[model samples]
Target chain A: MSVATADGLTLAGRDRRFGLLLTAPGLLSLLIVITFPLFFTLYTSVHDYTLLTPNYDTFVGTENYQEALDEEYLPGSLWVTTKFVLASIVIEFIIGFAVALSLHATRRFGSIYYLILLAPLLINPVVVGLLWRMLLHSELGIVNYTIGLVGISPVSWLGDADVAFWTVVLTDIWHQVSFMAILLVAGLAALPREPYEAARMDGASTIRCFIHITLPLMRPVIAVAILLRLIFAIKTFDIIFIMTKGGPGTATDLISYYIYRAAFFGLDVGRASAMAAGLLVIILALTAYLYRYMNSLK
Target chain B: MRLFLSVVAALALAVSAAQAQTIRILMETVPDTRYIQELLPQFEAETGIEVEIEAISYIDMHSKLVPQLIAPEGSYDLIVVDFYWVGEFTKAGWLMPLDDLVERDGVDVDVYVPKLMDLVGRVNGVLYMLPFYNYSMALIYRQDLLDDADEQAAFQEAYGMELRVPQTWDEYWKQVEFFTRDTDGDGNRDLYGTVIQGQRGDCISMQWANYLYSQGGLYHDENWNPLLDSPEAIRAMEYYREAVEKYSPAGSEAYCFDEAFNVMAQGRAYSFVTFNILYAGFEDPESSEVAGKVGITPNPGGGLNGGWGWAIPNSSPNKEAAWTFMKWAESAAVAKERAMLGGAPTQAQIFTDSDVVAARPYYPILGEILAGTKDFPVFTYTTEFVEQVGLELNLAATGEKPVAEAMAAAQEKLHALLVKDGKIEE
Candidate 1:
């Protein structure tokens, strides 16, 4: 019995060693790519690092953070970012869920419908911005030309301060609404039909059945989808960079683009890194909350 | 063993030779740089020295160059720096002072235009770069229209002035307003007057400089106190706002230089004031509808004077090879070649080159304009000033804020920035 136990212990130790060997490369890669940059950004936030005088000799702990927080434009950028995220997510969710329902109800050529829906999502964001910039050009664009044919005057899609904000929001939806639709469709497909059938037998209308059955059952998926999209929406930079560039009197200056201007244009990497670290913390807290919420659902 | 040793020796020699002979250059993707790229083979064929170029957009050049500039050894041996960066690059000790090299090489610096040289070549009595090109803004107009008999009669009757090239701001405004009418009978206001390049940052800054400088306004005094609140400054801002709000295209508030030029080129606008670098683009029949009908002159007050200068970075391992390329590129023969290819000329003689003169009738006028151009007051924070204050300028011009309030905000912002950089008294 002693010999058998010793052999078993040796076998278990070998198995553990083999597992470590298999994961070593991936672990090292994660450390190099993710952990190093994260620590460096935090380290940079504490020091007075600037491209103008790229060094860490001056240790200004939390002063950079203070300045980033106290930045005069910070509130404006945050307000703009919040408005953008809320507008984008609310519109995208409504449109995406409606499309998902229609697609779910279809019985034939569903794959063809999905192919058409996924095309815009597959094109790069920069390409989307460029294509739209041309298509929406006020004087020389096909959009205005078409509108002129119908007696509607040309609209300044990216020029007017009031209109440029909604223009950016609409461009984002055109690119990312597909992502929301696809996720909700997957959720809708996985839902069991027994609850719906039972409600129907009770003489419940379709709307009542949906409210009583589909929504309650799909709460977990809905929560996860909205959370994921909310996180993505908060980090928007590409469309603003390409289309408006936070222009028309700072009407579309989202937070991510503002931070970029601070880093490269302001040449204040220390302050910019502090802002970035602050942004990272907000994102991480949201993600942690999402994890807790998902677990709670379980 | 002997054969292996000899092979290793040969490889080492080859590597060292390649390293010594090859030089890398960086330039923004402007037309001049594109022409230089095309003419690089002539340089290599003549000197037997190889060259490499890394090109980037004008907006991204600063961000891309900083990392390499700060490195102990940089990748680029040569760079084309904008005039505004002359102070920033020199103060940072990032550029190699070129006075000694110029003396040693016996290169005649007299060929370069004097005002152009002063704007870009020398800083604090030190020569850091050779002038590459001048981008001083100039007025481009519809000369054919100005010469028409009926238009002149109508202009004299309407404004009691000749419909000729404007020599003052009031004349410019009157012409712009008068010319803003629908020529086609559809009555949709198809043709606008002037184009205002009020796009957020550099576009508005450069275009508005034509107004500001002509009105005798300067960005700051020697002590770094902003002069944006002076009478001249306020008047300049007011005039700019009036022009943009009253006579420009429907969405002129967001037009960049390219779009502004396009309005004139497409025969949609009567005239525009912009950089002379885009002059040749106006002459192209393929892109321009008003190709043969356009004219050129100096801006009424003066226009923004900006330029490119060729310099070697301090981190360069091969200065002599880079200097060789610069000398060849700036030689009279090659400069003429580039100018004929639609590159902005830095040499005085190139502006008068018979071949170039015949090709571009506006060349002589550009030379006069280059002399009177006003430059942005550059320091370490000049780019930041242009960015932030330019935003204020846009705000005022777009009527988002009043001119006085916006100018005050700009002055305060500039003061705070200068104080932070220790450029001025707190």
Candidate 2:
């Protein structure tokens, strides 16, 4: 018995070592690509560096961060980003849930409907932006033209500061809502029908059944969907870049776009790095809150 | 054994002979790219240097070039530097000075138009680039509309002056107002008087500068003090807003050069003030609805001297090969060839060349505009200044803020930026 136990212990230790050996390459790669950039950005945030004049690097600890705090556009852009993320995610979720419910209820031609809904998700975001830009053009677009037939005057969708923000949000939803719908549809399909059936048999209405049985069970899936969309929507750059370019007097200039303008257009690397660090902190805090909420749901 | 060895030696020699010197060029996706691509085969035949080209949209060119330039070794051997970037590029020491190469090769730098050379080639008395193409703003209008006998009579009656191509800002605005009326009496308005490049960031800034400079307003005095909040600057901004609001298309607030030029070329707008390179697009029958009806004039206010030049990056390993390519591309013969192939001519002689003049009748007018074109401030902080001013101008044009308020804000922002850059005292 003692000899057997020693052999088993040796086998278990060897297995653990082999598993670590297999994961070592992936871990090193992640450190090089992700961890290194994160630390470098943190380091750069403290230095007075400009890409144009690289020879003038000097250690100016916290000056960049202090300057960013004073910049009018930084806070404005952060607020814009927060508003856009919350508004887009909520709207996308509601509309996506509705579409998923509709698709799930349909028994005939459901696959065709599902495929059609998935088409927008497959399109490149930049292309979607350009497509929407043409479609929403005040004078030339078919969207305005079609609406004009119903006695609507031409509306400056992208040119008006009042409307440009919502236009961008709507365009984003149009492009990404399909993704949310697909995720929710899969979640709806995987749900155990027993509880819903029992609720229905007990004279519960469709809405009540959904609220008490379906939603409670789908909480984990919804949480995952929301978290994923939040992560992507916070870093939204391509669509805003292609469509409005954060224009109409910075109505839709989200934090990411502001950071890009600072880094690339302004060439103020230190300030841009500081802005990037600020964004990293915001994302980390939101992710932590989301992870806890998701765990609670589970 | 000897025969086999000789065959092997011959193969080695052939391989070495076929290994031609190659250079990579990064440039904007303008008509110049097409011209260069068509001219490359001949250049390769004459000199066995293979050229690889990467052309991107104008908006992306600067961002792409800056990163490559900042890298330890740049990816591009030759880069096309926009006029506004000359100061920044030179200040950063990213460009290789071409004086030695020009002296060694006896390249006649005098052949390029003097104003263009001044605008793009030189910074602080040092030549770091060679002017490749000119994009000076020119007044493009409908010759047919200008020559309309009844319209001219009505215009004279209404404005108490004979209607012709405007030579000043007040007359330009007057003409814009006169031409803004409906021509067809069909209740629906199809044509606008003019189009403004009012897109928020870059276009409006350049468009407004023409008016500002025409009113004798300089961005800075000799001491680099902020002069953007002066009365003349406010008047310029106000005039720009008036033109866009009163005479431009419904969506003119979002119009950039491409949209403004399209409105003119499609015969929906009576006139447009934009870059000279757009002449090719306006003349292309396939793309333009008013191909032969177009006329070109010197921009009423001094035209904006916007163009690009070819520079060898200091990090480029193939400096010699790149220099050779630049010289060949800028040669008078090649310049004329490119001009005939729809490229804007940088060489003064190309404007006078019979074939080029015949192909583009306004070549002389272009030459005149190039001679008198005014450039944006060429300073290290010029990009930041342009961006801030552009944002404010866009706000003013969109009616988000009043012209005076926007100009005041722009002035304050630019002053702070300059102080931070150590260009001015606190």
Candidate 3:
């Protein structure tokens, strides 16, 4: 029996080694392509490098960080990014949750509604931005034309600073709500119906049944959906870029757009990397916090 | 064994030699790419070489060029760059010294329009770009709307001038205001007085630059410090604000070059101040509802010229092909063909050609304006400086802030940026 056990141990060890060897190429690729660049960007953030003068880079150790912290740069961008993130996530969550609930309550043609609702999520953000930009055009845009019929003056959907912000928010919600809906649908489906039935038998109102039975049981799903949408909405770039490029006096310029201008437009890679690093830290912190909170709930 | 090894080395050397001379060319999408596209096959057939071309938009080209240039890896051999980037490109050493190439080819560099050629292509006295299809800003207006000279004069009397093409900033604004009268006499307004790109982007920067330069306000002084918010700059911004608020669409702040173009083409606008390149589109009856009604005149000047250029990258492997293509594209023959094809040509020689000039009767006046043009600041700090100015200018123009305070804040931020970039001492 001892001899057989020793042979089995050797076999298992060899199998593990073989598996590692097979994955070596993928491992190397991931390190080179992903891990290296990420660390390199972190390194660049502490230096002074502009693409136009690549050879002239100097170690500026946290200058970029300090500069970014200035009220003009970081604070305004943070505010814009926060507003965009909170607004998009809240709208997406509420709308998505409502859609999910309706789909669940409905008895027929459910799949068709699901497919139709899921369409926006599948469309590329760039295409969505272009479509909305055209629709929101003040002079020739159909949105303004339609609004004019109601005896309302055309609202500069993409021109006025305030209106442009709301336009971006609505466009974002329109595009991403489907993601939340699909996730919530899965959650709703997986939910145990016993508590819901019990609440209904006790003559609980629809709202009361949802609050006491449906929501309490679906906490894990809601948490996951919120986390997903929050992460996505924070990193939103394409739609804003296509629509306004953070325009009308930087009113709509989010942190992501600010970083893009720094890196690509400003050609200040070091500062851009610094900004990116700052974003990375914030995102990681938020993620950790969420994970801890989720754990605490358990 | 030695002989066999030698043979393998020889074969490897031969293979590497064959791959040594390849060039990549990047440019904006020209309608026919007539100059480069037509001559490329002939070039390859003659030179026993290969060429690859990548076409993108006016904005996309800059994003791609700047990153590649920063690396200086020489990934591309040739580039078709806009005239505005000449200064930025030359200062970065991302372009090869073309003085030798011009000398070797015995080409007279002076023949190219002085303004477009010198804009950014010369950094501390070195050429970096060649002029392709040259252009200057023009005022496109409705001819039929202004055909009655007596009516125009009478309106001008009420407004204060003869209303010939405006020669000054005030005159320009007056023209916009006068033309803006509700022609239909109906309660509902049918047309805007004018349309201009007022959005905070490259268009805003370009348009502002034209006006600012016209007012003789330099973006920076000798030491490269921010000089915007100077008296002249303020005046220019004020003029822009007044024009936009009084005559432009409600959402003028979001208007881009294309949107402004569409506004005039659709006949919603009585006049449009934009790039001369749009002349082709405006003249095409299919594209424009106001084809015969569309008239062109020299861009109203407070006395300044503006234009854009074609440039090659230092990294381009196909430098010869690119130069040859630029030459062929900018050649008199090509320019004439472009002119006859109903597009504007960059060459002065072509502008003088009767056949080319006759095809478009407005060519003479446009040619005169093109002759008087000048390029924007070609410094390395141009992009950043312009961005700051544009943001502040937009804020002021949009009534978000007092123009004076906004300009001051912009100047302060710009000064800091200049110092940080080492363009000026703190």
TM-score of chain A of 2: 0.94
**Model 1 RMSD, rounded to 1 decimal:** 2.5
Tens-place lDDT per residue, model 1, B25-65, is: 88898889899999999999999899999888887799888
What TM-score against the true chain A does chain A of each candidate get? 0.92, 0.94, 0.90
Query: Which prediction has more favorable DockQ, 2 or 3?
Result: 3
lDDT of 2 by residue, B95-167 (tens): 9999988999898899888888888888778899999898888778888888999989998899899888888
> Residue B33: error of model 3 in Å?
4.8
Fnat scores for every prediction: 0.44, 0.47, 0.64
Q: lDDT at B388 for candidate 2?
A: 79
Tell me how far the alpha carbon of residue B156 in candidate 3 is from the true structure, in angstroms, after superposition: 4.0
TM-score-based ranking: 2, 1, 3
Per DockQ, the best of the predicted structures is: 3
- Report i-RMS for every model: 1.3, 1.5, 1.5
Alpha-carbon shift of residue B97 in model 3 (angstroms): 0.9
In model 1, the runs with Cα more than 4 Å from the true position are A1-17, A193-205, B1-16, B185-187
True lDDT of residue B9, candidate 1: 100
